[model samples]
Structure formats: C-alpha cells, structure tokens
Target: MTAVTTDPRTGMTILDEDTCWSLLSSARLARVAIAIAGDIEVFPVNIVVDDRTVVFRTGEGTKLAAAVIAPRVAVEADGADPATGRAWSVVVKGRAERLDRFADIYRAEDLTLPDWTGHPKQWFVRVYGDQIAGRSFETAPT
Candidate 1:
C-alpha cells in the first residue's frame, strides 16, 4: 500500500493506485462495463491482472463486440473481510483491446486465469486506463 486516505466523518479509507492494483491483481471476479451505441452494458468476467491491465475471456456476441469497439471502458472489483466486516471496492477505467498477436496470447497463457463459465471463451481482451480509485469502510451488520 503506497498511500491511504481517510474520511474523518465516516472513517472510510481511500486506497491509492498501487493498493488498487494490488487488490485487482488478487481478485478473480470483476465487472467490466462497456458503452455500445448509446447505451452501456456490464458483464461479469473472470480476470487476471497482467502488469497494470485487466484481462478476461469472452465468446462471440455483445461482450466481444463491446470490447473491440468501445472507445473507453471500466473494470471494477470488490471484496469484504468477514472478520472485520470491512468492504472495499476498486475501479479501473481504460481502453479495451483484444489480444490478437501470437506473443501476447502466449504470454497470457502463462498466467493463472480462472474461468467459471463452461462455455468456450476464444477471445481475450484487456482493459487498461489511467484512472483507478478505491475505498474501504466498515459495513453495518445485516
């Protein structure tokens, strides 16, 4: 964790860029939001953070199209600590690009990518942006 910020009123902890990437690198599931036509679509994807980018697999359809065509995109992941009941969320905004080159694909294969979907995910897309922010705070009992 490089830097941390706190809100006096709510006691919320703000996470820095390094911390955000750290959380993202450990997270397996995340939601990728893309803009298509005039609307926005979000999809749950299993991800592996390679360097500073978020990579996920998808089959042909809207998700694939969005990844290829969308000018900008956002990927978000969150987690909660059961012991402390503290929840945190991290968001990454960046350009979505497909891995079409042989070297890139081969490199991606080396990483541990966990996919829950039984269907074939032939296409690999990576999202990377300059903006990333996160926060952690105590959660009330349910």
Candidate 2:
C-alpha cells in the first residue's frame, strides 16, 4: 500500500498512480463501460492487468461490437471494507482494441483469463491504459 492525501472538503483520500495500478493489477473483477447507440453501457468482466492495460475476453455481442465502433472506453474496479468504511476505486480510460490476429491472441493466452459465463469467448479486448486515476478514503464511523 502507498500513502494517501485526504481531501478536507470531501473527506476523501486521493491515491497515487502507482497505488492505482497496483490495485488494478490485484483486482480480478472490473466494470467496463462503452458508448453504443449514443448511450453508455457498462458490463462486469473478469479482467487481468497486463503491463498497464486491462484485458478481458468476450464472445460476439454488444460489447464486442461496441468496441469495434468506438474504441475509447473506461474500465473501473472498486472495493471497500463495510465495517470500517475504508474504500478504494480505480478508473482506466483507453482505447479498446480487439486482438484478432493470431500472434496477438497467442500472446494474450499467456495471461490465462477465465470466462465466468462459461461461453466460448474467442474475442479478446485490450484497453490500453492511457489515463489512469484512483481514490481511497476512510469515512467517519456510521
């Protein structure tokens, strides 16, 4: 864990980039958001952090189609301790590109991501971490 700076106004703590990346790397589940038909949609996926990018697998569907249309997307993961109200969240914004090439897919196979849906998730998407940010805080006892 890394040091945090508290925001007096909101009583929240700001997490640094290194901390954010570490959090993301340790997380297994994340929410991926993309714009489709002018409306933004979010989907929960089993993700793995490869270097600085978020990688996941999906079958041919809305998410796969949306990525083809608009590569820019946001991936977020958050967790908290309910008893103490200590929480943290990380957001990654980047272009989601499909790995259809044999070499690309082969390289991604090394990551060994499991598909929870138990479907044939042949398509792999990589969201390059262009902009990453996160926050963590300890709230007053409720």
Give each model's whole-structure lDDT: 0.87, 0.88
**What is candidate 2's CA lDDT for residue 58?**
89
Give the candidate number with the greatest TM-score.
1
List model 1 lDDT by residue over 1-142, tens digit each.
4447898899799999889999988899999998888899998999999989888888868888888888589999999888988888999998988889999888877878877696868888888777999988888898
In model 1, where do residues sit more than 4 Å from their true spots?
1-3
- Pairs that collide in candidate 2 are none
Count of backbone collisions within predicted model 2: 0
Q: How high is the lDDT of residue 40 in model 1?
A: 91
Give one digit per residue, the lDDT tens place, for model 2 in 5-39.
88798867778899999998888899999987789
Q: What TM-score, computed on C-alpha atoms, does each candidate reach? A: 0.94, 0.89
